[model samples]
Target: MIPAGFEYHRPADLASAVGLLQEHGEEARVVAGGHSLIPMMKLRMAELGHLVDLQAIGELKGIEIADGTAILGAMTTQHELIEHADLATAIPLLREAALQIADPQVRYLGTVGGNVANGDPGNDMPGLMQCLGARFELYGPAGTRQVAARDFYESAYFTARADDEILTKVTIPVPAAGTGYAYAKQKRKIGDYATAAAAVLVGTASASVAMTNLSDTPVWSEEAGMALANGDIEGCVAAMLAAIDPQEDMRGPIAFKKHVAAVILRRAIDSALSRRA
Candidate 1:
């Protein structure tokens, strides 16, 4: 299906992009990689009069490691993250999560910003970012504001971002030297959206556990993380599953999803902690 007719505007800078969005207000949308939005537009699930393309903005495509954080530009592709040597070592969990998103073709064109900022409950990156305590840099007609990744997603297809703002970058605090992490996703097939997925990160004495596709927003189980830190593996898994109210949708039955979440949580915890031993 063809996308609804729309005027395209490519801005070479963030300020111009923001201004265009502000001018168009509800009638315009930003396009980064277009892997996610274009498909939705084709289905008419999204319709807009104008598109503010950020591709021409050269600054929004690099990765920087400094001050104990890995900052990724909004236009950075999944392939870039997967192949970056520094990022791969600094946060193997992020690389693992990136590898699990769709297949080669999709990963080549899908930007990390679009994957998470789209606010789709099924995308694998948001929950992973939450588990890692990442931060989002948002820019708009007002100014710039930083938001914790966990607070970014309000619900499926909705976020804290105003219609006029663009997610400029994601900054992940570099994990401690020996920190352990894992991302375990259970999808029905190679390119399928996960049925249930878990991303876990454990520091010396602290931990975090988050789940994707199990709720309206990426679900971070603080209680479960605490349980894991206390060495109560069973309790941690139970707490994580408890936080979820699985829906019986076309994806799977509620009971089955709950079971998958439990199983994946267990594996994710084990994988994350195994690095310590």
Candidate 2:
């Protein structure tokens, strides 16, 4: 299905994009890779009078590492991220998660910024970002503001983005020495959304566990992670199940999703801890 008619604007610079968004407000939608937005537009779930394309903005298209953080530009493609050597070495969790995002064709066109900024609970990156303690950089007429990954998503398919703001970059902290990370998801097929998933990053003493498709928003279970860190797998599993409230849907029943989430959490923990051992 073709999307509804919309005025297209390619902004060459950040200022132009922000100005356009400020003027158009809710009537406008930002298009990066368009992998997520275009489908919704075609379904009429998203209607925009104007599309402010960010592809022409050159600064928003590269991978750079500095100050012990991987700064991924909002427009960086998933394929680009998968092949980045620095990211591969410094933050393999992101690289590992990126490879599982979608098929190769979609990965070539899907932007990391679009994935997380869309705030879809089914998307893989949000949970991984939460585990990695990533920071989102929001740019607008008010200048730039940094939002922690934990605070970025307000609900499923909803974000902290204001009418006049754009997400410009994702800043991931360098993991501490001996830290380990893993991401696991149960999908029906390649390129399919996760039925249930877990992303875990563990240090010698603590762990961060984030799950997707189990609630209104991606949920990071601090209590469960603490239990896992204490070497109480049963307690950790119980806590995880208690924290998730997956709804019954065509994807799977709530009980099954909760069960799958627990299984994935166990695998994620094993994968993460094994690397450190």
Q: How many clashes in each candidate? A: 0, 0
Give the total clashing residue pairs for model 2.
0
- Report the number of the highest-lDDT candidate: 1
Task: Show model 1 residue runs off by greater than 4 Å.
Answer: none
For all predictions, the C-alpha RMSD in Å is 1.0, 1.2
lDDT of 2 by residue, 234-268 (tens): 78888888987899888889878887888888998
Candidate 1 scores a C-alpha RMSD against the true structure in Å of 1.0
- Which of the numbered candidates is closest to the native, going by highest TM-score? 1
Off by over 4 Å in 2: none
Clashing pairs in 1: none
- Residue-level error in angstroms, candidate 2, position 70: 1.3
* Total clashes in model 1, counting residue pairs 3 or more apart in sequence or in different chains: 0
Q: State residue 191's C-alpha deviation in candidate 2, in Å.
A: 1.4
What is the Cα-based TM-score of model 2?
0.97
